[model samples]
Target: MNSTGKESRHVNIHIASPVEEVYSYASDPANLPEWALGLGGSIENVDGQWVAESSSMGRVVVTFSPENDLGVLDHDVTLPSGETVHNPVRVIADGAGSDVVFTLRRRPGMSDSDFRRDADMVAADLARLKALTEPGQGPR
Candidate 1:
């Protein structure tokens, strides 16, 4: 935890793809289910809002940042209880490839095991992203 009493972990992965390509792929909500399994197995747009019906936290709404060249894929997930969790994600250029990072924050009153679980989930999602974006692995 930092001096502000906020506990966070930066879970990231290196993808063997250009930053632009990775950002384009990761920024689209339609492609989320293909890699972001931690969010859900499927997602659909409902009246301009992305809704994931089978997410781990049950049905939830996801709001992504506006499209930009900064590789910012930040999104807010509104839980069933109406609480919104802001997830900070980024795809940065790393030579010929890109480095995708997800900052997982520990919620208030959360247990140690829960924080670890969230970190593991984020790590797995990044790995999936790497698999899907890397050359000769899966679809571009």
Candidate 2:
């Protein structure tokens, strides 16, 4: 929680890879399902939109930020209810590796349990990303 009255948590993981490599992998919408299990089991580019068909929240559309050198992997997920949730993510250089950070915000009227669950899911997703981007993971 901050001065904005919105409760939030920063869930992050240190990946054993360079910022460019990690950002390149994470920024690609096609590679999302391999790491972002919280989003869905699979995703496809429907026309120009990225749709997650098997998402727990039902079919949702994901819009990602344009690729840049700053390592920003932010995205917006549009729920079935027509509400769009902005997810802020970043990959920062950390020595020879990189730290991937996700800012998880609690929506209004959400229960404490639900917020915690979302945080856990984000942490798990980061872990999976770390595994995939690590040195021995090869080219994912």
Q: For this target, which candidate reaches the highest lDDT against the unseen true structure?
A: 2
lDDT of 1 at 10: 95
Candidate 1 lDDT, 11-124, residue by residue in tens: 999998999999998998999999898899999999989999764699999999999999999999999999899999999999999999898887777778878888998899
Cα-based lDDT for every prediction: 0.90, 0.90
Clashes of each: 0, 0
Cα-based TM-score, every candidate: 0.94, 0.93
TM-score, structure 1 vs. true:
0.94
- Residue-by-residue lDDT tens digits, candidate 2, 12-89: 999889999999989999898899999999999899999997547999999999999999999999999999999999
Q: In candidate 1, what residue range of length 10 has the lowest lDDT sum? A: 1-10
Stretches off by above 4 angstroms in model 2 are 1-5, 137-139
Please report how far candidate 2 places residue 61 from its true position, in Å: 0.5
Q: Native-vs-model 2 lDDT?
A: 0.90
lDDT comparing candidate 1 with the true structure: 0.90
Please give the RMSD to the true structure for each candidate, in Å. 2.1, 2.3
